[model samples]
Target: MKIAGFDIGGANTDLAIIDFDQGGDIENIKTDFRYLPMWMKNEELGGYLLDLIGEEIDQLDAVGVSMTAELVDAYETKKDGVLDIVKKVEDTFDIPVAYVGLSGMMNASQAISDPLQVAAANWIATSQIASIMSQNCILVDVGSTTTDIIPIKNGLECARGRSDFERLGTGELAYTGTLRTNVAAIVDKVPFDEGWFRVSSELFAISADVHHVLGNITTEEYSCDTPDSAGKEKEDSLRRISRVLCGDLDLLSTSDIESIGDYIYAQQSLKISEAISEVAEREFLDEVITTGLGRNILAARAVEMAGLDFTGMDEFLTPEECVVAPAVGTAIMMEDYLSDE
Candidate 1:
């Protein structure tokens, strides 16, 4: 059997294709993470999705979907966004599609009736899989736009909240991320040249700039467009980070700009560490399972800083699989659901 799963978000769309043998053993897995920027080009989403999984779409036995794109500004209301995305998926594919909701998998009609259950539920899918892997562990997924710190105990998801709002209150969700988060959101002040200085709130730089300057991610790994709309070159990244302090290359030395990146990175790491401490204290989970695009550079450092034992998802999954764990989890869940029936 072959199953395809999709996790659609505001900035990126992740897809996973899994093939199982006759006895339901895993045969092959292929995954793709695409930067769609759904808010800017809502009309082109269907075509882009189709292009991502070209020939394999015809071979799939079923499709499972989880989404967070409803929060994008392209729609007036979340309901409108949910219904529109459902329509696009239905119009593009000709298979038994199941939307992964908060409760369980549902058909498109059922999903439309309960839009709230489907909105921003991709984290649940990833956490469910993590629970199956480790009974008492915290799953920390730091993606391009947000971080999810979920607790699993006794082989079940023990999250304190189901919705993003409740999760935020419970310290289960942090809006800080690796790629697109604004630097201003992470820190209002940074230390440079043995003194602290306030950051400019001009949206002139983002977290990607900081990461690029610190060598946390490669130039190719910097997926989003740069703040200046120039390029992802190291020099460009350094200039952008300098702008955070309202200083350019001419005004600041390279070491000064690097110091700014280090400070911001430490601040972001502390944010995730604090959230991990909050969640870990409740369940006493000692092991942290970190996954997502930023796991190596951000999540691992955060876990270490929090003084907890950590395991990268790469220890269990391929590098490509780690980036789209939620999509793979949705597919695995759908495969299990079908196997039981």
Candidate 2:
């Protein structure tokens, strides 16, 4: 069976195409993601979906979807956004389509009936991999815009919070992520030049800039728009990061800028670490399974910082596959749903 799964978020839409043997074992998997700012082009989603599918459109047996794009500012309410996105998927293909909801996979009719059931539920699809990977662990997926930390035990997702709102209170959701998070959201002050320099709340730079300067991700991997709309080169990142201190290159030396990047990186890791600690302690889970774009750079580092056992999803799937694990999981899940039917 061939299945395509899409994880649509506010910033990026990730696609996973999986081919399964008759025995239901994955034969091969291909994944890719595009930066589609839904706020500006929510109407063009159908085109983006078709572009991702490309030639595979003729071969796909089914398409599964999980989305967080409903929470984007493109719509006045989550319900409205959900309806619009669902319509696009429904209109885009004649093949079988299902939406990944909080309760496993929902048919297109069910999704349209209760849109909130599927709104911002991409994390749940990603968490399904835990039962196959480990018996007791927390699944931490750090994407470009947000991090999903879900607890699973004895082959079941045992998250205390079902919604993003509830997850935030349970420490299962941390708003900061690898690329798009504002640097100011991570820290208010940085220690430099023998004094603590407070950062500007202005959108001078994003986590991508700091990660670029720190060499965590490549310039090409900085898929989100740069804060200053400048080049994604290291120097451009350095200059933008300097603005976090309310200054430019002329005011901050290279060493000073590197220091700021280091601090921001540490704090970002610490944020995830603290959340991991809280969730791990509350759930009695001692190991972490990290995946997604920031899985290695941020999630693994945060796992170490939280003083827990760490397992990168790359161990089971290639790093490329792990980067889009949610979509992969959603595809596998849809395949299962269809087979059962």
Candidate 3:
């Protein structure tokens, strides 16, 4: 059988393809992944994505779709977005399209019967994937705009008491990231030549500037959106951070820029630490498994703040590959569901 899985996230959409016959090992799998900006804004995003797959759609025996879009809005808005995509896929391919449940980690067989209930339970793609990667631990995924903290025990997701709405207050669901966060959110004051000066809340620094200075993400990843990240130069990163100080790049030296970046990390770290503590207390799990682009840095600061040890996903998987670990894990879950039937 030819199978394909797609994970539509807030920042990017990832697609993975696999081939397998009945009672045979699935090999020769190929994956095609891409990063798109403002993906949720494209009304025809469903059709736009199908066009990318082209002929591959015809060869697929089954296709699966999963997303965290429900977290984006209210019930009707989310339902419309998901169903629209599902209808478009079915209309184009004439194949079965199963929407992964958003509330809990379950197979299509189980999810198909009651996706609403599943999604309502916070059935996210990460938990499904985390179940396969770790035994008993907290899964921390820091995405473009937010971070998710999920606790797993004995292959099942533990009810952490706090819902998505609650976590949002603790920095798990904010419009901040390692590459895109506004500088104003990190600090209220900036040091000038002599003493200190207040910063305008209107001005913000890109999370890229912060991560670059902190040595978390390299220039390669920072090259996309920052004002001067195109050249992949340290000077550009410095300039990006300095821009937050009202385009006064020369006002602050490179060392000062680095200091501001460190300050931002420290600020964000405090917020992350609070979120981690809430999750630990709610689930009674002390350990946190970190993943995603800023997982390493966020986890490090969170550990120090919470007095907990941090386990890096990189210890088991490469950073680039780890970003899509949930997609891979969801596909693995799909394979298991298909085999059981």
If scored against the real structure, what TM-score would every candidate get?
A: 0.97, 0.99, 0.79
lDDT (CA) for every model shown? 0.88, 0.91, 0.62
Candidate 2 residue lDDT tens string, 1-341: 89999999898999999999998899999999889999998999999999999998999999999999998888999999999999999999999999999988999889989999999988888888866889889999998888999999988888888889899999999999999999999999999988998989999999999888988999899999987777999989989988888898999988899888898899999999999999999998898899989998899899999999988888888998888888999998999999899
Per TM-score, the best of the predicted structures is 2
Predicted model with the maximum lDDT: 2
lDDT pick, better of 2 and 3 = 2
- Report the lDDT of model 3 for residue 196: 68
Q: Please state the error at residue 242 of candidate 1 in Å.
A: 1.0
What digit string (tens of lDDT, one per residue) describes model 1 on residues 85-154? 9999988889878888887787899988888889898988898767766888999999988999999889
Worst 10 residues of 2 by lDDT: 123-132
For model 3, where is the 10-residue window of minimal lDDT?
A: 114-123
- Model 3 regions more than 4 Å off: 18-32, 39-41, 47-59, 69-76, 103-123, 161-163, 169-175, 191-194, 227-233, 315-318
Error of 1 at 123 (Å): 1.0
Candidate 1 Cα RMSD after full superposition onto the native fold (Å): 1.2
Candidates arranged by lDDT, highest first:
2, 1, 3
lDDT of 3 by residue, 1-341 (tens): 77776766555666667677676456645555555442445355566567656678778776666665444443355555445444555565666555556443454455545545334232355666566567777777776556677778887776433445654654344345566677777677776667766666663456777787767878776633554435546676677677777655668887787887777788787777777787777667777777776777676666569887667776765666466655555555566656666
